[model samples]
Target: MTPVRLAFCIALALSAAPAFATDEAPPQKATNLGEVDVNARLDEARNSLSPDTGSSQYVMTRQTIQALPLGDSTPLNQVVLQAPGVVQDSYGQLHVRGDHANLQYRIDGVLIPESIGGFGQTLDTRMIDNIKLLTGALPAQYGDRTAAVVDITTRTPKDGVGGSVGITGGQFGTVNPNATLFGKKDDWSFFLTANYLKNDVGIENPTASRTAIHDHTNQVKAFGDVSYLINNDTRISFMFGATNNRFEIPNNPGQTAQFGYLDVTNFDSAQLDERQQEKTRFGVLSLQGKMGDTAYQVSAGERYSSLDFTPDDIGDLMFNGVASDVRRANRATTLQADFATPLGDSHTLRYGVYGEFERATSTNNALVFPADGDGNQTSTTPLNILDSSRILARTYALYLQDEWSIGDKWTVNYGVRADKYNAFKPESQLSPRLGVVYQPVDGTTIHAGYSRYFTPPASESISPTSIAKFVGTTNALPDNGNDTPLAERSSYYDVGISQKLGTQWTVGLDSYRRNVSRIQDEGQFGAAVVYSTFNYDQGKVKGDELTVNYDGGALTAYFNFSYNRSVGKRIITGQYNFAPDDLAYIQDHFIHLDHDQKYTSSGGISYAFPDSTRIGANYLFGSGLRRDGIVPNGDTMPAYFQLNLSVAHDFNLTSVGATHAQFALVNALDRTYQLRDGSGIGVGAPQFGPRRGVFLSLQQDF
Candidate 1:
């Protein structure tokens, strides 16, 4: 059957299912007392499904998040950058352990499907109660996109009703307003949040100037969660989220035109009016309960995302000889179940199953000038062409693992997982994982692990260009082959140790290495800021990280440093996206990936006073990303650093319940740096970092 028909059938079946709850009177206090016990048991059961046995886990609580320069207003990607082995890049992207864009996100122990690559932020920081970043060799339950795992726990209300409203605005024509409401009564609980933002610096600037030309954005996001307690041992919950964002494509002025369109020849590059729109909606429904000695939870989820790129016809034709309007959309439906049960005195068994179905579509309307064999334009008038494609794919996975405790000093976990993917082609794999944790002394811990991984390319972002149809046009390519992206298979090894120096300080060191075949990576190869995936024949990546943390009565501090090296030998897929000389050189020699940075470091310190006032500061440093030299990715850009500071205070008013205010200084040193030079393989345009700015916010809680 077709994907459309399958989706329709599933929808019908879900609608026909019987409801689990109805209108009934609130339970008594005795029942609520029993619920307290069940909630703790459920939390423990959920924690067992995702074990961080032999991985490097970094956690940030709600208090830590609020202590940052921007507080809840900081983007999720920026928050993750504070962890070890995370490198920042242009367009709000993060590379962990020398791997490009392979992170998995989970909320409340439920997986959230990946969306198409874009410049907008989908998940808001305000909804997070606590966030954890897990890296290195992982356990058996984690599959697919495994560069890192972002595990998040959402906020929940205490008891009564309460809410907050806030507004933040600053330089660069910025304004933001947000509100949140949460409450619990009897057996029903709910939380909801909404926000709107408008800013001038949406995308990175194309030059080193203080302000970017034609760069502005408007965005709106909303999320809701509701749950009902069926009894002392069972509950049902539902979650939904939505985001709509629009951005203007930034431009670089003083560029000479290379081609003419119709009667127009000279056009101002800074005045070009190009825009992009992104929208996403997702929902998940879950059922949790316990029977006998087994604990289990089942969930169903769906997500839809779309992006549209509108081009300036005359400006684009004169600049690059081609003007394209692109539209892409993807929809996914998923089902997951997990169970944990204790066998004897020394063993705990955990198993799970997952399935997903996805459909993606792409449409392109392009106008191109007629060209000769020498790639010289022969006609001033442009003609239009329509190119479109669609794909349907499915994935299934099953895993089983056991955690065994030998004694008080040692623990081991071993498991295996099988996965089958049916997309443009069919593929299957069976991977094994093993991990050991040892505690030899007081306040000292050591861990070692090895894992085999199988990763499939993102289905929503794979759209092959029709090379033959563009021949004899200005949009033609120099190469001929267009191979489909393949799955990546790899072996990973990791070792780490953590020790406590005294009562207030702790330090850790970790090292990891991976050897991969058919390794996957992504890049922006078009005028639109969308990414495409490709494969390398062989890849090797290695990294080491050092971390130190301190916590006293009223002061806190942390520092992290990482060194990474990543190289790929051959471009086995997506040949049309590379030049012949670069491909030949890479086939013979190893070259660094475009997003790889050799050294990265971040540190922060915060202090709280007795008068309910807090002062905080943070710093970030990078050795720089790769650029083009004599060969592909042979040179690096200049190093750079940034500093930020914040001050916040609480106030109690007689008329209002409570109020808070904050002031922040971003990029305090006013340093200028380039993130991309637009000269490497599959690089599209130049981009620079943000300049200095000041921001202020006020909030009222009741």
Candidate 2:
């Protein structure tokens, strides 16, 4: 069925289902708490003026996600798109800060994947508690991303023991279920969430010679976080996570012969499969003790992480039913220490020094299948054909920062970091950051800052520079070596102002520009150029954003809008112009160049029922984004409207407190359309997915 038809059916079925009974009582009053303003990851005192994390900061509140617009119970990737500076393309990638592709992704301040590259994929957003975007001057402890930074901190239950399960099923055999098990007690806490989604599809928006094929995906994800207080002055935490996903895509796209006519059944569908798995484990121990007349902190940590991807078949070859296979792994360990001091009453200073050691290995092999003349199945690929090789990459970093007090009305922050990569030879770099803030009155501030960044290329994308014969070789060598390389330098400059109008409203404006000298050929370097694991030259990007928020005890709302432009090129590629304008695998001169969007203009009204039940209705309107250029010359789709509702009630059961039952109807008005496309030709069907869906939750506090 066409995506539009699917949206219509979903709308009809929702109207027929029992609507959540509205509780007409006034909403319960609320107040923001804690110095760790989650949205901005800043102190409340500092938040009073510059409150919105809207531009450089992106947040996905759990309350808002449970009521998302997609048909399947909400996925993490879907929630991420709700944040400004994030864009999704036809192939399910999360592009942030205008695709200079300098995205440094991390968890609790540790370098993941070990290589200079990032692990790219669509995550189930339900598994996350918070998502933070750092467009400029990311903390000193975080390193190696040339463009921007993304940090994810999982949720740890606030109440006693409880859990919730949700399932969404509709057009195209989409079946996705997610569940969470968590609990918190006295001084110790534990949390866990597990999810899986698999669906089949029949191709549409057919190209001239392309045939329809069946496609299915099986994805499973799990996350757990446990923490404990060693004492009033100390705390320790540990985290374990896993992601296993496999996609059995439809038939491959290849000509029957290099110079022959097109054939639809030329490749097999069942023969195509892609498997990816990642596992992470880390521990944090921190002490809040005093070192002198002022306060201080000392923390230590150990971490282990791994990523493996094995693609069994490359093209679903009909001749031998065998294709190429590849594998890669990275592991690391580190010792960290930090200190915080006060330069004065008005100015507080914080600085940290840290070191890390990492080990990594990569392998790639292509099997030769001696198939019969007509392309029939023979024996399985050989095990002895193992052409295995391993290499180790090393690195260490040191950083320091000072949060200075300009006076009772102004503050300044400046810091610098240095890093060295030890492999083949040693390459070193220094990154610097500077920021200034001024508070003119009780709850208002204007800030400006600039920072330099560096990113090394991923291991897979780097080719070895030198190789010598291990054994006797007359045109026959036992092994070939691959050298690792680093991505060039990058930098950013930002300026903004924020102010609290009074007791109920706040607004802010921010602008930034970033440039990277070296990009990966695929993940970090000119990764999109020449299809080699090589590096590309100079690329530039810039953008602007604005945010506003209003809250009055019983009511709260926010809206964020951003504009951006990105350009990628082969400026200094040894006089080679493979595709000067193209950013990566995408067409040149044509980039996700510009963007504009606004959100959360909607409002929520909650009423209390006589039996102690509450109901809420929230209206939402989202602007469309482009993976191609922001303004298409011919036909440009603007924006659309949507409504969502949620209801839940609590009742007394015993002295320990009873349970709460809840349900939500997302995308009250199902609107199906394409969101993004990496291709400039616009040949793809605009990127299709599900429409509206339902969700249910049950929780108990004891």
Candidate 3:
């Protein structure tokens, strides 16, 4: 964007901040509406209609996430695309809105300090109950990751002894098996899930011929929460969970273009293997108290994680080294207290504050490998690497939110969070969030919201380790700078309207904006041969979205559209980096790339039957990702459409196995579309993705 245009937008945004401060209406209690608040991004659980879900906090209910189809369950990055205003970043990192990877991933609030080459951490979705993508500012109640925070809460067991076991097999000998167990009582609940699997790839990369890969993985999670009633007004609660993962990529190598592909033909490539392993555990304990019209709660938690990684290759290092093994360990503790006091008969004031302490350490095994003049590998080195470092930090914060109500017509929600870190750069920061809803009639409401939040640098940037082989010397390692601070802040604005339209119909429309300062740029080239990790300049983005939804008796439907206008300028030199680009998807149609959904659209419709039988279908269309057509990895995958359908029969089929059975067919049309070539080094993979597939299972409730 031009300097003049940017300046004008900022001016207009500031001037419009206080234009709609409305608090003169009756507050509507979500007692009946199974509505999820899009504004509270972090607190949408209240609007959720299911009791089996964790809400009023950052909780994801299993029923919802389990229903959404997630492709490539290996990498944790691809699973979060189901939410609004969130998308995967360039490469494989996730970018909340336009936010960068200067974010953090917490397992039950405990931090994971590991770097998968340039990718973030490997996430195990099978053991996850829900994932809360906290992209905005760090709420006072939580610590770390300014631009956004992703809280990955693993599945906890319920009160019964029932678990789900599943196996998904596709092209290239891929197998994913998952299981979940839940146990629940009147005052206690527990949920647990375990998954193990391995995959053989067929991504169309030029190096697909010379590689031999054998990868395996395992994930285990346990959750248990109990609430005791000391009396009627005073109660105590405890929630605890543990999670573990192990991934291994034996010997992943693919030939260069000259070596030729191993398989004559495939949907993509049948070679190229990726291996890794990770594990984490975390839990929370809290107490709730109530006196007269005052209610309060206090809680504390501890988290620990251990991760191990061994990559097969980088760029075209199809030969030479065996593997770059690395390990990361971290632990975190938090203390928070909050209360809600009644203001009067018609209004209530709520406020709270919290303090937290976190510490984490990671060690990278230094590697000694043979290299050519350009840092490309040629030969040598059996075992040469060191893994040990102390990386720690702490934070403190405070926040207050008040919901004011008048007679009937409008209400306002206002809150702000202030945070300060004990380590690294960046000063105390604040996130101010506000929202207003005006109900002109009983079935209609006009709502608008805005928030200002910033993101700090990520854990990886604080200290980076890299090893290089000089032309004549044996091996030398260079330190990635700690000079760049994790300091990036953004101001966001959203406006939309909602209408009941009657008892069976509802609709909404929304638009948003985000401008950030001091975005962390890890140079243009990813893991540059000479420079391990560096910093870059500033960036800006503005976008709009439109959505129309309808929910009725036996039938419900959804339609959504999103578009963004974004650009970045190099601080070192004012030029655009074309190689990696922004948080955009390239293999949109190829291999069903999720990020290509940008400037794209989606719609779905379903109906219910009287005998617990229902059927539905969905449609996806997009503009397709853009790519450098002239480059070797060039070639933009076009847009595509996928159709899916399923049927469930609820009956007393104790004879079959359990309570019910579901037979599902994915890629129902048997229509196979080309996915991105998975072996993307510079330009990315060039092969076709998966093909038509099927999945089946049976379940019983006790």
Best by lDDT: 1
Q: Per-residue lDDT tens digits of candidate 3, residues 1-702?
A: 456644443332111100011111224332221233221221222112111000011223343333334322334553454333444333344544444444566554434433323322345565576665543222233334544456665555444455655555544355656655666455455555545554443222223332224433444544454555455455565666555555433332343321111232221223434444555566667666555555566667766655555553331122323234455655667776666565664444555665555565655554445545544444433334564556566667777766666557766666777877666544678787776656667755555556666554444334443333223212333222233345556666554444455565544444455565654444322221111222234455665444455556677665645565443433321112222332123212112112223464555565667877656555544444433444322445555555555555556755534444444454566544443433222233333323444544344444
**Model 2, stretches more than 4 Å misplaced?**
1-55, 58-73, 90-92, 100-131, 139-141, 146-148, 151-189, 192-215, 250-265, 268-315, 318-322, 367-391, 423-425, 460-485, 520-534, 571-702
Q: Model 2: how far is 338 from its true place, Å?
A: 2.7
- Write model 1 residue lDDT over 4-97, tens digit each, in one string: 6434322221100000010011100111113355556566556666776666678887788888888888888989988878898888889999
Question: How accurate locally, in lDDT, is each candidate?
Answer: 0.82, 0.47, 0.45
Identify the superior model by lDDT, candidate 1 or candidate 3.
Answer: 1
Stretches of candidate 3 exceeding 4 Å from the true structure:
1-80, 86-94, 100-216, 248-254, 257-274, 311-323, 370-388, 460-463, 466-485, 520-536, 571-597, 619-637, 655-658, 669-690
Model 2 lDDT, residue 486, Cα: 50
TM-score of each: 0.94, 0.69, 0.71
In Å, residue 504's CA in model 1 sits off its true spot by 1.3
Report the C-alpha lDDT of model 2 over 1-702, residue by residue, as the tens digit.
245643432222110000011111110111233344232222121212111111234444555454344422555544555554555433344556565244665554433343322222434465565555555445454566544455665665766787666565554466666777788787677887777766653222112222224345566767676767554434456655666655433333342411111233344433545444444444545443334423333445554544454444434233333233545555555555545554545444455555555555555443433334443323334221334455565666777766656546656666787877765567778988776656567655555666776666544334332123211111112231223445567777666655566766656566666776754434211111111243445556666555556555444455555566655554232112122233234323323332223221333445557776656665434455443443231122345555666776776765655665566666566665444332332222333433464655554444
Worst 10 residues of 1 by lDDT: 14-23
lDDT, model 2:
0.47
Candidate 1 stretches greater than 4 Å from native: 1-37, 654-657
**RMSD of model 3 against the true structure:** 8.6
